[model samples]
Target: MVENSNLLAEQRRALILDEVRRRGGVRVNELTRRLNVSDMTVRRDLDALARQGVVEKVHGGAVPVMEASTHEPGFEAKSGLELTAKEDIAREAARLVAPGSAIALSGGTTTFALAQHLVGVEGLTVVTNSVRVADVFENAARGGSAASPAATVVLTGGVRTPSDALVGPIADRAIRSLHFDLLFLGCHGLSVEAGLSTPNLAEAETNRTFVASARRVVAVADHTKWGTVGLSTFARLSEVDTLVTDSGLPAEAREELAEHLRSVLVAGAEGPATSG
Candidate 1:
Protein backbone atom coordinates (compact mmCIF):
# COMPACT_ATOMS: atom_id res chain seq x y z
CA MET A 1 0.00 0.00 0.00
CA VAL A 2 2.81 2.40 0.82
CA GLU A 3 4.54 1.91 -2.52
CA ASN A 4 1.30 2.19 -4.39
CA SER A 5 0.42 5.39 -2.58
CA ASN A 6 3.85 6.82 -3.42
CA LEU A 7 3.26 6.09 -7.06
CA LEU A 8 -0.09 7.84 -6.90
CA ALA A 9 1.53 10.81 -5.26
CA GLU A 10 4.05 11.07 -8.08
CA GLN A 11 1.27 11.01 -10.63
CA ARG A 12 -0.60 13.75 -8.84
CA ARG A 13 2.56 15.85 -8.72
CA ALA A 14 2.87 15.59 -12.46
CA LEU A 15 -0.73 16.67 -12.76
CA ILE A 16 -0.08 19.72 -10.65
CA LEU A 17 2.78 20.85 -12.89
CA ASP A 18 0.57 20.34 -15.90
CA GLU A 19 -2.18 22.39 -14.36
CA VAL A 20 0.14 25.19 -13.32
CA ARG A 21 1.61 25.30 -16.77
CA ARG A 22 -1.83 25.25 -18.29
CA ARG A 23 -3.34 28.04 -16.23
CA GLY A 24 -0.11 30.01 -15.74
CA GLY A 25 -0.82 29.51 -12.01
CA VAL A 26 -3.35 28.19 -9.53
CA ARG A 27 -4.50 29.35 -6.14
CA VAL A 28 -4.23 26.99 -3.17
CA ASN A 29 -7.98 27.01 -2.70
CA GLU A 30 -8.46 26.48 -6.43
CA LEU A 31 -6.13 23.50 -6.40
CA THR A 32 -8.04 22.02 -3.51
CA ARG A 33 -11.30 22.54 -5.34
CA ARG A 34 -10.07 21.52 -8.76
CA LEU A 35 -7.93 18.57 -7.75
CA ASN A 36 -10.65 17.53 -5.32
CA VAL A 37 -8.30 17.15 -2.39
CA SER A 38 -8.14 18.47 1.13
CA ASP A 39 -6.29 21.70 1.77
CA MET A 40 -3.58 19.83 3.65
CA THR A 41 -3.08 17.45 0.77
CA VAL A 42 -2.93 20.33 -1.67
CA ARG A 43 -0.37 22.08 0.50
CA ARG A 44 1.83 19.01 0.55
CA ASP A 45 1.68 18.78 -3.24
CA LEU A 46 2.45 22.46 -3.58
CA ASP A 47 5.37 21.99 -1.23
CA ALA A 48 6.72 19.25 -3.44
CA LEU A 49 6.29 21.44 -6.51
CA ALA A 50 8.11 24.25 -4.76
CA ARG A 51 10.95 21.90 -3.84
CA GLN A 52 11.35 21.02 -7.50
CA GLY A 53 11.43 24.72 -8.42
CA VAL A 54 8.55 24.65 -10.87
CA VAL A 55 5.66 26.50 -9.24
CA GLU A 56 6.08 29.32 -6.78
CA LYS A 57 4.11 29.45 -3.54
CA VAL A 58 2.44 32.76 -3.12
CA HIS A 59 -0.06 34.26 -0.67
CA GLY A 60 -3.07 32.74 -2.38
CA GLY A 61 -1.77 30.14 -4.81
CA ALA A 62 1.12 28.91 -6.90
CA VAL A 63 2.21 30.61 -10.12
CA PRO A 64 4.70 29.49 -12.77
CA VAL A 65 8.24 30.21 -11.58
CA MET A 66 8.79 32.52 -14.56
CA GLU A 67 5.97 34.75 -13.40
CA ALA A 68 7.30 34.57 -9.82
CA SER A 69 9.34 37.68 -10.30
CA THR A 70 8.50 40.97 -8.62
CA HIS A 71 10.03 43.08 -11.51
CA GLU A 72 10.54 43.22 -15.31
CA PRO A 73 11.06 45.69 -18.10
CA GLY A 74 7.97 47.64 -19.04
CA PHE A 75 6.27 46.83 -22.34
CA GLU A 76 7.76 49.81 -24.14
CA ALA A 77 11.27 49.37 -22.85
CA LYS A 78 11.52 45.81 -24.08
CA SER A 79 9.49 46.17 -27.29
CA GLY A 80 11.34 49.21 -28.55
CA LEU A 81 14.71 47.64 -29.11
CA GLU A 82 15.75 45.18 -31.85
CA LEU A 83 12.25 43.85 -32.55
CA THR A 84 12.88 42.44 -36.03
CA ALA A 85 16.36 41.25 -35.20
CA LYS A 86 15.16 39.44 -32.09
CA GLU A 87 12.37 37.71 -34.03
CA ASP A 88 14.68 36.51 -36.80
CA ILE A 89 17.09 35.18 -34.24
CA ALA A 90 14.24 33.53 -32.33
CA ARG A 91 13.10 31.75 -35.50
CA GLU A 92 16.62 30.43 -36.05
CA ALA A 93 16.90 29.22 -32.47
CA ALA A 94 13.53 27.49 -32.60
CA ARG A 95 14.64 25.47 -35.60
CA LEU A 96 17.49 24.02 -33.55
CA VAL A 97 15.22 22.49 -30.89
CA ALA A 98 14.52 18.83 -31.50
CA PRO A 99 11.40 17.25 -30.10
CA GLY A 100 11.81 15.30 -26.84
CA SER A 101 15.07 17.04 -26.06
CA ALA A 102 16.13 18.27 -22.62
CA ILE A 103 17.11 21.91 -22.84
CA ALA A 104 18.13 24.70 -20.50
CA LEU A 105 17.44 28.36 -21.21
CA SER A 106 19.09 31.16 -19.32
CA GLY A 107 17.52 34.50 -18.42
CA GLY A 108 17.59 37.41 -20.89
CA THR A 109 15.27 39.19 -23.28
CA THR A 110 16.51 37.27 -26.29
CA THR A 111 15.95 33.95 -24.57
CA PHE A 112 12.43 35.11 -23.81
CA ALA A 113 11.92 35.59 -27.55
CA LEU A 114 13.29 32.10 -28.17
CA ALA A 115 10.74 30.75 -25.71
CA GLN A 116 7.91 32.28 -27.74
CA HIS A 117 8.91 30.38 -30.86
CA LEU A 118 8.93 27.08 -28.97
CA VAL A 119 5.18 27.03 -28.53
CA GLY A 120 4.49 24.51 -31.30
CA VAL A 121 7.30 22.04 -30.69
CA GLU A 122 6.17 18.75 -29.20
CA GLY A 123 7.70 16.60 -26.45
CA LEU A 124 10.36 19.03 -25.28
CA THR A 125 11.61 19.23 -21.71
CA VAL A 126 12.72 22.74 -20.87
CA VAL A 127 14.59 23.84 -17.75
CA THR A 128 15.06 27.50 -17.10
CA ASN A 129 16.16 29.86 -14.35
CA SER A 130 14.21 32.84 -15.55
CA VAL A 131 10.75 33.56 -14.20
CA ARG A 132 9.90 35.33 -17.45
CA VAL A 133 11.00 32.39 -19.52
CA ALA A 134 8.86 30.04 -17.44
CA ASP A 135 5.81 32.21 -17.91
CA VAL A 136 6.40 32.25 -21.63
CA PHE A 137 6.34 28.44 -21.71
CA GLU A 138 3.30 28.30 -19.44
CA ASN A 139 1.37 30.66 -21.68
CA ALA A 140 2.38 28.77 -24.78
CA ALA A 141 1.21 25.52 -23.25
CA ARG A 142 -2.07 27.08 -22.21
CA GLY A 143 -2.87 28.45 -25.63
CA GLY A 144 -4.07 24.89 -26.22
CA SER A 145 -3.26 25.17 -29.89
CA ALA A 146 -0.93 22.19 -29.93
CA ALA A 147 -0.64 18.92 -28.00
CA SER A 148 -0.74 20.80 -24.70
CA PRO A 149 2.99 21.15 -24.45
CA ALA A 150 4.23 17.61 -24.02
CA ALA A 151 7.34 19.36 -22.74
CA THR A 152 8.18 19.04 -19.07
CA VAL A 153 9.01 22.57 -17.93
CA VAL A 154 11.16 22.96 -14.84
CA LEU A 155 12.28 26.18 -13.17
CA THR A 156 15.37 26.75 -11.01
CA GLY A 157 14.85 28.50 -7.67
CA GLY A 158 16.99 31.28 -6.20
CA VAL A 159 17.15 34.95 -5.39
CA ARG A 160 15.68 37.18 -8.08
CA THR A 161 17.77 39.71 -9.96
CA PRO A 162 16.86 43.06 -11.54
CA SER A 163 16.50 41.22 -14.82
CA ASP A 164 14.20 38.74 -13.09
CA ALA A 165 16.86 36.04 -13.31
CA LEU A 166 17.08 33.41 -10.59
CA VAL A 167 20.58 33.25 -9.13
CA GLY A 168 22.51 32.42 -5.94
CA PRO A 169 23.00 29.11 -4.14
CA ILE A 170 19.74 27.34 -4.96
CA ALA A 171 19.98 27.96 -8.71
CA ASP A 172 23.66 27.07 -8.90
CA ARG A 173 23.16 23.77 -7.06
CA ALA A 174 20.14 22.80 -9.14
CA ILE A 175 21.85 23.54 -12.46
CA ARG A 176 25.13 21.87 -11.55
CA SER A 177 23.44 18.65 -10.53
CA LEU A 178 21.64 18.14 -13.84
CA HIS A 179 23.01 17.46 -17.32
CA PHE A 180 21.16 19.01 -20.24
CA ASP A 181 21.25 18.12 -23.93
CA LEU A 182 21.42 21.72 -25.05
CA LEU A 183 21.72 25.01 -23.22
CA PHE A 184 20.39 28.26 -24.76
CA LEU A 185 22.00 31.07 -22.78
CA GLY A 186 22.15 34.84 -23.22
CA CYS A 187 24.34 37.48 -21.65
CA HIS A 188 24.36 41.15 -20.80
CA GLY A 189 27.74 41.49 -22.47
CA LEU A 190 30.01 39.50 -24.77
CA SER A 191 33.58 39.81 -25.98
CA VAL A 192 36.24 37.52 -27.37
CA GLU A 193 38.56 38.27 -24.47
CA ALA A 194 36.05 38.79 -21.67
CA GLY A 195 34.02 35.75 -22.72
CA LEU A 196 30.48 35.68 -21.27
CA SER A 197 29.76 38.66 -19.04
CA THR A 198 26.88 39.93 -16.92
CA PRO A 199 26.62 43.04 -14.82
CA ASN A 200 25.37 41.05 -11.86
CA LEU A 201 27.93 38.76 -10.29
CA ALA A 202 25.40 36.20 -9.13
CA GLU A 203 23.85 35.87 -12.60
CA ALA A 204 27.27 35.47 -14.18
CA GLU A 205 28.04 32.59 -11.82
CA THR A 206 24.65 31.05 -12.54
CA ASN A 207 25.27 31.14 -16.31
CA ARG A 208 28.66 29.56 -15.79
CA THR A 209 27.15 26.58 -14.00
CA PHE A 210 24.64 26.08 -16.83
CA VAL A 211 27.56 26.15 -19.26
CA ALA A 212 29.37 23.42 -17.32
CA SER A 213 26.28 21.22 -17.07
CA ALA A 214 25.16 21.24 -20.69
CA ARG A 215 26.52 18.92 -23.39
CA ARG A 216 26.36 21.81 -25.86
CA VAL A 217 26.21 25.56 -25.21
CA VAL A 218 24.53 28.01 -27.59
CA ALA A 219 24.94 31.69 -26.84
CA VAL A 220 22.02 33.78 -28.15
CA ALA A 221 23.21 37.33 -28.00
CA ASP A 222 22.42 40.41 -30.06
CA HIS A 223 25.06 42.56 -31.66
CA THR A 224 24.47 45.25 -29.06
CA LYS A 225 26.22 43.06 -26.51
CA TRP A 226 29.27 42.56 -28.67
CA GLY A 227 31.51 45.23 -27.11
CA THR A 228 29.49 45.73 -23.93
CA VAL A 229 31.27 44.93 -20.65
CA GLY A 230 29.86 43.50 -17.47
CA LEU A 231 30.96 43.05 -13.86
CA SER A 232 32.22 39.48 -14.11
CA THR A 233 33.32 36.93 -16.69
CA PHE A 234 31.55 33.58 -16.91
CA ALA A 235 32.73 31.29 -19.75
CA ARG A 236 35.51 31.52 -22.29
CA LEU A 237 34.67 31.98 -25.97
CA SER A 238 35.92 28.50 -26.85
CA GLU A 239 33.60 26.89 -24.32
CA VAL A 240 30.53 27.83 -26.37
CA ASP A 241 29.40 25.31 -28.97
CA THR A 242 27.66 28.01 -31.03
CA LEU A 243 27.38 31.77 -30.87
CA VAL A 244 24.11 33.16 -32.32
CA THR A 245 24.22 36.84 -32.99
CA ASP A 246 22.87 39.45 -35.36
CA SER A 247 24.71 40.91 -38.35
CA GLY A 248 25.59 43.97 -36.31
CA LEU A 249 28.69 42.15 -35.07
CA PRO A 250 31.89 43.94 -35.97
CA ALA A 251 33.75 42.21 -38.80
CA GLU A 252 37.13 42.26 -37.08
CA ALA A 253 35.87 41.04 -33.70
CA ARG A 254 33.58 38.41 -35.21
CA GLU A 255 36.53 37.06 -37.16
CA GLU A 256 38.60 36.90 -33.99
CA LEU A 257 35.99 34.91 -32.02
CA ALA A 258 35.20 32.70 -35.03
CA GLU A 259 38.59 31.11 -34.66
CA HIS A 260 37.62 29.79 -31.21
CA LEU A 261 33.96 28.68 -31.06
CA ARG A 262 32.76 25.50 -32.72
CA SER A 263 30.35 27.49 -34.88
CA VAL A 264 28.77 30.92 -35.08
CA LEU A 265 25.24 31.32 -36.37
CA VAL A 266 24.53 34.94 -37.34
CA ALA A 267 20.88 35.58 -38.06
CA GLY A 268 18.68 38.71 -38.41
CA ALA A 269 19.95 39.52 -41.87
CA GLU A 270 19.89 38.14 -45.41
CA GLY A 271 22.25 35.21 -44.83
CA PRO A 272 24.78 33.59 -42.50
CA ALA A 273 28.28 34.99 -42.61
CA THR A 274 30.70 32.12 -42.01
CA SER A 275 34.46 32.25 -41.52
CA GLY A 276 37.13 29.76 -42.56
Candidate 2:
Protein backbone atom coordinates (compact mmCIF):
# COMPACT_ATOMS: atom_id res chain seq x y z
CA MET A 1 0.00 0.00 0.00
CA VAL A 2 2.76 2.39 0.88
CA GLU A 3 4.62 1.67 -2.36
CA ASN A 4 1.39 2.11 -4.31
CA SER A 5 0.80 5.46 -2.62
CA ASN A 6 4.29 6.61 -3.61
CA LEU A 7 3.63 5.61 -7.21
CA LEU A 8 0.40 7.56 -7.21
CA ALA A 9 2.17 10.60 -5.91
CA GLU A 10 4.70 10.41 -8.70
CA GLN A 11 1.90 10.03 -11.24
CA ARG A 12 0.11 13.06 -9.87
CA ARG A 13 3.32 15.02 -9.97
CA ALA A 14 3.78 14.11 -13.61
CA LEU A 15 0.26 15.24 -14.28
CA ILE A 16 1.01 18.54 -12.59
CA LEU A 17 4.16 18.99 -14.66
CA ASP A 18 2.28 18.24 -17.83
CA GLU A 19 -0.45 20.68 -16.90
CA VAL A 20 2.00 23.44 -16.22
CA ARG A 21 3.90 22.81 -19.40
CA ARG A 22 0.72 22.69 -21.40
CA ARG A 23 -0.78 25.82 -19.88
CA GLY A 24 2.55 27.56 -19.16
CA GLY A 25 1.48 27.78 -15.49
CA VAL A 26 -1.35 26.87 -13.18
CA ARG A 27 -2.91 28.26 -10.02
CA VAL A 28 -2.71 26.34 -6.76
CA ASN A 29 -6.41 26.76 -6.08
CA GLU A 30 -7.21 25.44 -9.51
CA LEU A 31 -4.85 22.55 -9.03
CA THR A 32 -6.43 21.64 -5.72
CA ARG A 33 -9.90 21.62 -7.26
CA ARG A 34 -8.82 19.76 -10.40
CA LEU A 35 -6.87 17.11 -8.56
CA ASN A 36 -9.49 16.95 -5.82
CA VAL A 37 -6.70 17.08 -3.27
CA SER A 38 -6.18 19.23 -0.18
CA ASP A 39 -4.26 22.49 -0.42
CA MET A 40 -1.44 21.03 1.68
CA THR A 41 -1.19 18.00 -0.57
CA VAL A 42 -0.96 20.15 -3.67
CA ARG A 43 1.74 22.31 -2.10
CA ARG A 44 3.70 19.28 -0.96
CA ASP A 45 3.53 17.75 -4.41
CA LEU A 46 4.69 21.01 -5.96
CA ASP A 47 7.57 21.23 -3.51
CA ALA A 48 8.73 17.75 -4.35
CA LEU A 49 8.38 18.42 -8.05
CA ALA A 50 10.36 21.63 -7.67
CA ARG A 51 13.16 19.70 -6.03
CA GLN A 52 13.20 17.33 -8.99
CA GLY A 53 13.56 20.10 -11.61
CA VAL A 54 10.10 19.38 -12.86
CA VAL A 55 8.55 22.69 -11.95
CA GLU A 56 9.27 26.21 -10.76
CA LYS A 57 6.96 26.97 -7.89
CA VAL A 58 5.57 30.45 -7.58
CA HIS A 59 3.63 31.91 -4.68
CA GLY A 60 0.30 30.54 -5.86
CA GLY A 61 1.26 28.44 -8.86
CA ALA A 62 3.92 26.61 -10.80
CA VAL A 63 5.49 27.20 -14.23
CA PRO A 64 7.46 25.33 -16.87
CA VAL A 65 11.11 26.42 -17.03
CA MET A 66 12.81 24.64 -19.94
CA GLU A 67 11.87 27.21 -22.54
CA ALA A 68 14.51 27.85 -25.19
CA SER A 69 16.88 30.80 -25.17
CA THR A 70 15.77 33.24 -27.88
CA HIS A 71 18.70 33.17 -30.27
CA GLU A 72 21.78 31.13 -31.02
CA PRO A 73 23.35 33.99 -29.03
CA GLY A 74 26.50 33.80 -31.06
CA PHE A 75 29.78 34.39 -29.27
CA GLU A 76 29.41 38.00 -30.36
CA ALA A 77 25.80 37.99 -29.18
CA LYS A 78 26.79 36.77 -25.71
CA SER A 79 27.50 40.15 -24.09
CA GLY A 80 24.05 40.34 -22.52
CA LEU A 81 22.65 40.43 -19.00
CA GLU A 82 24.57 42.06 -16.10
CA LEU A 83 27.85 42.58 -17.95
CA THR A 84 29.55 43.71 -14.80
CA ALA A 85 28.19 40.61 -13.17
CA LYS A 86 29.86 38.34 -15.71
CA GLU A 87 33.13 40.30 -15.36
CA ASP A 88 33.06 40.03 -11.60
CA ILE A 89 32.19 36.36 -11.76
CA ALA A 90 34.97 35.91 -14.28
CA ARG A 91 37.48 37.61 -11.99
CA GLU A 92 36.46 35.61 -8.95
CA ALA A 93 36.48 32.41 -10.96
CA ALA A 94 39.94 33.27 -12.25
CA ARG A 95 41.11 33.61 -8.65
CA LEU A 96 40.46 29.89 -8.29
CA VAL A 97 43.35 29.38 -10.69
CA ALA A 98 47.01 29.40 -9.66
CA PRO A 99 50.11 29.82 -11.75
CA GLY A 100 51.28 26.59 -13.41
CA SER A 101 47.92 24.92 -12.88
CA ALA A 102 46.33 22.72 -15.54
CA ILE A 103 42.70 23.42 -16.33
CA ALA A 104 40.10 22.26 -18.83
CA LEU A 105 37.47 24.60 -20.16
CA SER A 106 33.99 23.52 -21.13
CA GLY A 107 32.58 24.92 -24.33
CA GLY A 108 30.51 27.71 -22.80
CA THR A 109 30.64 31.42 -23.47
CA THR A 110 31.62 32.21 -19.88
CA THR A 111 34.55 29.82 -20.14
CA PHE A 112 35.52 31.55 -23.36
CA ALA A 113 35.61 34.84 -21.48
CA LEU A 114 37.89 33.15 -18.97
CA ALA A 115 40.22 32.24 -21.83
CA GLN A 116 40.44 35.87 -22.89
CA HIS A 117 41.15 36.84 -19.30
CA LEU A 118 44.08 34.41 -19.11
CA VAL A 119 45.90 35.79 -22.17
CA GLY A 120 48.89 37.31 -20.35
CA VAL A 121 48.76 35.28 -17.15
CA GLU A 122 52.22 33.90 -16.50
CA GLY A 123 52.12 30.10 -16.66
CA LEU A 124 49.03 27.98 -17.26
CA THR A 125 48.04 24.97 -19.32
CA VAL A 126 44.54 24.51 -20.73
CA VAL A 127 42.72 21.86 -22.74
CA THR A 128 39.54 22.76 -24.54
CA ASN A 129 37.07 21.69 -27.25
CA SER A 130 36.12 25.05 -28.64
CA VAL A 131 37.24 26.59 -31.91
CA ARG A 132 36.73 30.07 -30.52
CA VAL A 133 38.69 29.27 -27.38
CA ALA A 134 41.52 27.68 -29.32
CA ASP A 135 41.55 30.80 -31.46
CA VAL A 136 41.81 33.01 -28.36
CA PHE A 137 44.86 31.17 -27.08
CA GLU A 138 46.36 30.85 -30.55
CA ASN A 139 46.04 34.60 -31.08
CA ALA A 140 47.60 35.34 -27.70
CA ALA A 141 50.40 32.88 -28.40
CA ARG A 142 51.11 34.77 -31.62
CA GLY A 143 52.52 38.03 -30.20
CA GLY A 144 55.43 36.68 -32.29
CA SER A 145 57.85 38.09 -29.78
CA ALA A 146 56.96 36.59 -26.39
CA ALA A 147 57.47 33.16 -24.86
CA SER A 148 54.61 30.74 -24.17
CA PRO A 149 52.93 31.11 -20.75
CA ALA A 150 54.18 27.66 -19.83
CA ALA A 151 50.85 26.93 -21.45
CA THR A 152 50.20 23.99 -23.71
CA VAL A 153 46.68 24.01 -25.12
CA VAL A 154 45.13 20.77 -26.26
CA LEU A 155 42.02 20.94 -28.39
CA THR A 156 39.84 17.86 -28.28
CA GLY A 157 39.35 16.59 -31.82
CA GLY A 158 35.73 15.94 -32.84
CA VAL A 159 32.92 17.14 -35.06
CA ARG A 160 31.63 20.54 -33.89
CA THR A 161 28.16 21.20 -32.52
CA PRO A 162 25.84 23.93 -33.74
CA SER A 163 27.28 26.03 -30.93
CA ASP A 164 30.79 25.31 -32.24
CA ALA A 165 31.56 22.72 -29.56
CA LEU A 166 33.48 19.56 -30.27
CA VAL A 167 31.75 16.43 -29.01
CA GLY A 168 31.17 12.70 -29.67
CA PRO A 169 32.96 9.47 -28.83
CA ILE A 170 36.29 10.92 -29.88
CA ALA A 171 35.98 13.87 -27.51
CA ASP A 172 34.56 11.59 -24.83
CA ARG A 173 37.51 9.22 -25.08
CA ALA A 174 39.95 12.14 -25.05
CA ILE A 175 38.44 13.57 -21.88
CA ARG A 176 38.47 10.17 -20.17
CA SER A 177 42.27 10.09 -20.42
CA LEU A 178 42.64 13.63 -19.09
CA HIS A 179 42.24 15.25 -15.71
CA PHE A 180 42.24 18.85 -14.57
CA ASP A 181 42.72 20.96 -11.47
CA LEU A 182 39.52 22.71 -12.39
CA LEU A 183 36.87 23.00 -15.07
CA PHE A 184 34.95 26.19 -15.71
CA LEU A 185 31.65 25.38 -17.37
CA GLY A 186 28.00 26.27 -17.80
CA CYS A 187 24.66 24.68 -18.78
CA HIS A 188 21.20 25.44 -20.13
CA GLY A 189 19.49 24.07 -17.01
CA LEU A 190 20.60 23.16 -13.49
CA SER A 191 18.22 21.70 -10.98
CA VAL A 192 18.50 20.07 -7.58
CA GLU A 193 16.86 16.92 -8.90
CA ALA A 194 17.79 16.90 -12.58
CA GLY A 195 21.44 17.73 -11.95
CA LEU A 196 23.39 19.66 -14.57
CA SER A 197 21.75 19.20 -17.93
CA THR A 198 21.64 20.60 -21.45
CA PRO A 199 19.27 20.34 -24.37
CA ASN A 200 21.83 18.51 -26.46
CA LEU A 201 22.43 14.90 -25.50
CA ALA A 202 25.72 14.62 -27.36
CA GLU A 203 27.02 17.65 -25.53
CA ALA A 204 25.78 16.25 -22.23
CA GLU A 205 27.61 12.98 -22.80
CA THR A 206 30.84 14.81 -23.59
CA ASN A 207 30.39 16.99 -20.49
CA ARG A 208 29.87 13.90 -18.36
CA THR A 209 33.30 12.63 -19.35
CA PHE A 210 34.76 16.06 -18.82
CA VAL A 211 33.28 16.42 -15.34
CA ALA A 212 34.38 12.93 -14.40
CA SER A 213 37.98 13.87 -15.20
CA ALA A 214 38.08 17.15 -13.31
CA ARG A 215 39.09 17.49 -9.68
CA ARG A 216 36.68 20.35 -9.26
CA VAL A 217 33.70 21.65 -11.22
CA VAL A 218 32.79 25.31 -11.37
CA ALA A 219 29.57 26.39 -13.07
CA VAL A 220 29.64 29.80 -14.72
CA ALA A 221 26.06 30.67 -15.53
CA ASP A 222 23.90 33.73 -15.07
CA HIS A 223 20.75 34.15 -12.94
CA THR A 224 18.49 32.71 -15.62
CA LYS A 225 19.88 29.18 -15.64
CA TRP A 226 18.56 28.42 -12.22
CA GLY A 227 15.11 26.83 -11.68
CA THR A 228 15.30 25.33 -15.15
CA VAL A 229 15.66 21.72 -16.32
CA GLY A 230 16.98 20.56 -19.66
CA LEU A 231 16.62 17.39 -21.77
CA SER A 232 19.73 15.45 -20.74
CA THR A 233 21.62 15.56 -17.46
CA PHE A 234 25.40 15.90 -17.09
CA ALA A 235 25.87 16.09 -13.33
CA ARG A 236 23.90 16.55 -10.19
CA LEU A 237 23.92 19.84 -8.32
CA SER A 238 25.90 18.25 -5.49
CA GLU A 239 28.73 17.49 -7.90
CA VAL A 240 29.75 21.13 -8.08
CA ASP A 241 32.25 22.96 -5.90
CA THR A 242 31.16 26.48 -6.75
CA LEU A 243 28.63 28.40 -8.86
CA VAL A 244 29.30 31.86 -10.31
CA THR A 245 26.42 33.80 -11.79
CA ASP A 246 25.05 37.32 -12.12
CA SER A 247 23.61 39.08 -9.08
CA GLY A 248 20.18 39.27 -10.62
CA LEU A 249 19.46 35.73 -9.39
CA PRO A 250 16.44 35.54 -7.15
CA ALA A 251 17.14 35.13 -3.46
CA GLU A 252 15.23 31.88 -3.47
CA ALA A 253 17.30 30.61 -6.35
CA ARG A 254 20.53 31.41 -4.51
CA GLU A 255 19.28 29.67 -1.40
CA GLU A 256 18.21 26.72 -3.49
CA LEU A 257 21.65 26.39 -5.09
CA ALA A 258 23.38 26.88 -1.75
CA GLU A 259 21.46 23.86 -0.56
CA HIS A 260 23.47 21.70 -2.93
CA LEU A 261 26.60 23.55 -4.06
CA ARG A 262 29.51 24.58 -1.84
CA SER A 263 29.04 28.28 -2.59
CA VAL A 264 27.30 30.66 -5.01
CA LEU A 265 29.29 33.61 -6.32
CA VAL A 266 27.25 36.58 -7.50
CA ALA A 267 29.12 38.83 -9.88
CA GLY A 268 28.66 42.53 -9.40
CA ALA A 269 28.04 44.93 -12.26
CA GLU A 270 31.35 45.75 -13.89
CA GLY A 271 29.79 46.95 -17.11
CA PRO A 272 30.09 44.77 -20.21
CA ALA A 273 31.95 45.40 -23.43
CA THR A 274 29.91 47.95 -25.34
CA SER A 275 31.61 48.92 -28.58
CA GLY A 276 32.46 45.30 -29.36
Best by lDDT: 1
User: Please, what is the whole-model Cα lDDT of each candidate in the order they appear?
Assistant: 0.76, 0.73
Segments of candidate 1 deviating more than 4 angstroms: 1-79, 145-148
Candidate 1 on 188-258: residue-level lDDT in tens?
66777788887778888899999999999998887555554577888888888888876655455567778
Which portions of model 2 miss their true places by more than 4 Å?
Answer: 1-82, 144-150, 270-276
- Each candidate structure's TM-score, on Cα atoms with residue i matched to residue i, is 0.70, 0.70
